[model samples]
Target: MCILFVALEAHPEYPLIICANRDEFHHRPTEAAHFWPKQNRLLAGKDLEAGGTWLGVNQNGLIAGLTNIRDPELIQSDMKSRGELVLKALINDGIDESWLARYSPFYNPFNLLYGDEKALYCFDSRAKRLNQLTAGFHSISNGALDDIWPKMSRGTQAIQAHITNNSNPCIDSLLAIMKDGTQAPDADLPQTGVSLEWERHLSSIYIQHQEYGTRSTSIILKDKRGKVQFSEVRYDGKGRNLGRNDFSF
Candidate 1:
């Protein structure tokens, strides 16, 4: 997942709301969101290449998502696939900070967001720090949790405004916010070790490119009654919709 917006206890009807966009190469093989046949309790899309998921939720209300840290210099070709972190988090009884701390070094830099509705935490592999999120709105991207990158700030404000205006927000409204393609001003772009052209291409909330861009958007809502609604929409490199999947449990 490239970017994720989280709202905890900020909505009257839903206690937890998550909207995330998975940005990757168009050629990567992926499976749409579904209840894994092997692990029926898990709901998520699979990265066929890595044999893992980017975001997922289990039968017991546990949620986990991951984002790569934008530090190209620290990436090692032999490092473990970060996608497995999400699966590990979902299948395990609960998050073990010590386990993460011990194994994080084996993988590339990343930020792991995992927990239940009652509480959520972010583990920063680069910094090796674990933080428990407070009740409010937050955004995470290729940097640390709640880093004020231009896209992160823009998306965060847009979702907060939508929630504040609509008493009961719908999946379409949240998906619209994630579809924003407006790029940030050149002066507002953060220097993340990429070319200026590449930076500009990735500045928008919804990236559009012939090679690397947003591949899917996932929205998850958990109500006060403990019921969950999960939705995922897939897209091509040209930003054309491929298909959508919805599940409730």
Candidate 2:
């Protein structure tokens, strides 16, 4: 989604593990996480209008998510349609790090992740860039290529520090994203030099639409052992978790 941190080829046992918080406005009609009865696949939710999903992982080790390139004036009623990104990614066959660069499909300025348990590659469509992170430490946020995309360089680095110090259990990095820091991401912005508050908060990492928003979170774990596990959940108003679903590919 918008604010996503990826652990690519870092763990000795998994190829990639992703932890992200998909942010959006409070109003959007969405379905809960469930196994698609017709497709027999696990997904966060389906856009009834388009038969697409917000985020999903199939048994083929394919993982995909979406986020909008934030521009307030972009009030276009229909944005290339992110829902299509989620659904098309999983079922498609011609997707890889190299193929992504040439993929001219339509979607909000977003990112895509797909790999097994050995190596990982990420493509940020907004910048038209592709990166393969070092096996030991890796991450990604919204902005073009900045440390403050997450608005928490310290938090991200703090987790990296823990991962290096211990280095045994990579779970520490995943925990950092899930936990809230004592001081919000703002206090450390100055240390990051030009990390602006409004920019980070309203950063195009998250997006909203008239009837729908990506108010969900997803995590995909692929250990070095070639085992892939993932979790996708969607939430609604009142902070009610509509449901949670998990699957391994």
Candidate 3:
């Protein structure tokens, strides 16, 4: 997943809102938001190619998303399948940040987002080091440090500002550098780079997908009773429903 925007109990109306975009090669294997027939548990898109999911959620409002750290040099794939990382974190028995960090998942330098009723936190494992982002609101893309990627830096600022300045609705912001092979100028982004392009078409504010190549968008709304209502927007992105289905859980 490249670009993402998420709100974790950061607002009064909607406690958890996640909007993200996943960019990858056409050959990469992916399963959009749905209840896995074999597992019977709802999951975000899974990368059957890499064996990990970009994002997923359960019925109880347990949400988790993962983004890979891309570099010029290819990182050797470990024997442990990356797909298991999503199943490991998202299927947790509901743990806190401190507890989640200790998972020691298969991949290092991973950008992970995990949350339940109590709270949510973003984690970074750059250079094989893991750290829990301090509570409050945060965003991440792909880079050496937080808020450093060209477009992603702006996305981080937007997330904090939208969360701190407004609370009526809540802002959804998530960003990552992607090699989509299509270059376009974006308002949120001043200019586009050759290595990574700023793609607004792939961006979402409230988990709505309707354009080509866009797979699924999921949103979570938490009420004062500490309950959550989850919904998903799924599509073929090429304007075809095909066999696509969106499920919340």
Candidate 4:
């Protein structure tokens, strides 16, 4: 997942609302969101190359998503796949602070967001920090949590506006926000070791590079009744919408 914005306990009817986009190289093989056959309770898109996932949820009401830290300097080929982190958290119902602390050191720098129905947590490997997010709105990208990157701020603000104006929040509005392709002004772009051109390209919530870009946009909503609505819209390498899947539980 390259970008994610979550609203927690913000709406009376819904306890959690999430909008996210998963970015990757165009050629990487991936499967759209679905129930994992091996782990019958799990729902997520599979990273065929690594046998893991970027985001997922289980019937136990556990949700997990991950984003890579933009640190080319710290990346090592031998490090474990960060996608595995999301899968591990979803697979084990007993994962806790101790579990994250013990195993976090093995992977490359990453930002992991995971939680049960009651609470949400974020772990930043670069800072070696873990935070239990309070009830409100939070956003995460390739940087620190809620760091106010232009894209994160835009997404959160859009969500706030939608929730304030509409009683029944729909996935279409959230997906529209995620589909925005407007690039940030050059001055507002975050310098994350990539070239200025690349930074400008990634500034938009929806990335459209020929080689590496957003592969899918996922919106997940969990209400107080334990019902979950999940939708994923996929795209081809050139930014053309491929198809979409919707499921409710």
Q: Evaluated with TM-score, which candidate comes out highest?
A: 1
lDDT value, residue 32 of candidate 4: 90
* lDDT, each prediction: 0.93, 0.54, 0.51, 0.89
Can you give the TM-score per candidate against the true fold? 0.98, 0.69, 0.64, 0.97
Kindly list the per-residue Cα lDDT of model 4 for residues 1-249, writing each as its tens digit. Answer: 799888899888888888899999989999999999989899999999998899888897778999998988888899889898898889985356776778877898899999955878999988878888888888999999999789888888888899868889989988998999889999999989999999998999999988999999999999999899999999988889999999899
- The top-ranked prediction according to lDDT is 1
Candidate 1 clashing pairs, residues 3+ apart or interchain: none
For 1-249, candidate 3 gives per-residue lDDT tens digits of 655655556666565656555545444556666566665555566666665677777655677776655543535556355456667666664435554355544454566666654666566654544444443455555543355444454444565565566654431222221112232255443222223332343333222233334454444555555554444444453433334343322
* Superior candidate under TM-score, 1 versus 3: 1
lDDT of 2 by residue, 1-249 (tens): 455666555545454666666665555445655667766644456656656765666656666665444544433565566667667667773165555566634455666654444445556776787755456544455444334544435445654554445545444345434443233445433222233744333333233333333466666676665566666655554445667676665
| Model 1 poorest ten-residue lDDT run | 87-96
Report lDDT (Cα) of residue 14, candidate 4. 87
Identify the runs in model 2 with alpha carbons over 4 angstroms from their true place.
41-44, 73-75, 94-106, 117-119, 145-147, 150-155, 158-176, 179-214, 233-243
lDDT for 28 (candidate 1):
94
Per-residue error (Å), model 4, residue 209: 1.3
Question: Cα deviation in Å at residue 170, candidate 2?
Answer: 8.8
Single out the weakest 10-residue window by summed lDDT for candidate 2.
203-212
What's the CA RMSD for each of the models?
0.8, 5.2, 6.3, 1.1
Kindly list the per-residue Cα lDDT of model 1 for residues 1-249, writing each as its tens digit. 899999999999888999999999999999999999988889999999999999999999889999999888898999999999999998883578999899999999999999977889999999999999999999989989998889999999999999878888889999999999999999999888889999999899899998999999999999899899999999998889999999999
Candidate 4, which segments miss by more than 4 Å at Cα? none
User: TM-score of the candidate numbered 4?
Assistant: 0.97
lDDT of 2: 0.54
lDDT of 4: 0.89
A best-first ranking of the candidates according to their TM-score comes to 1, 4, 2, 3
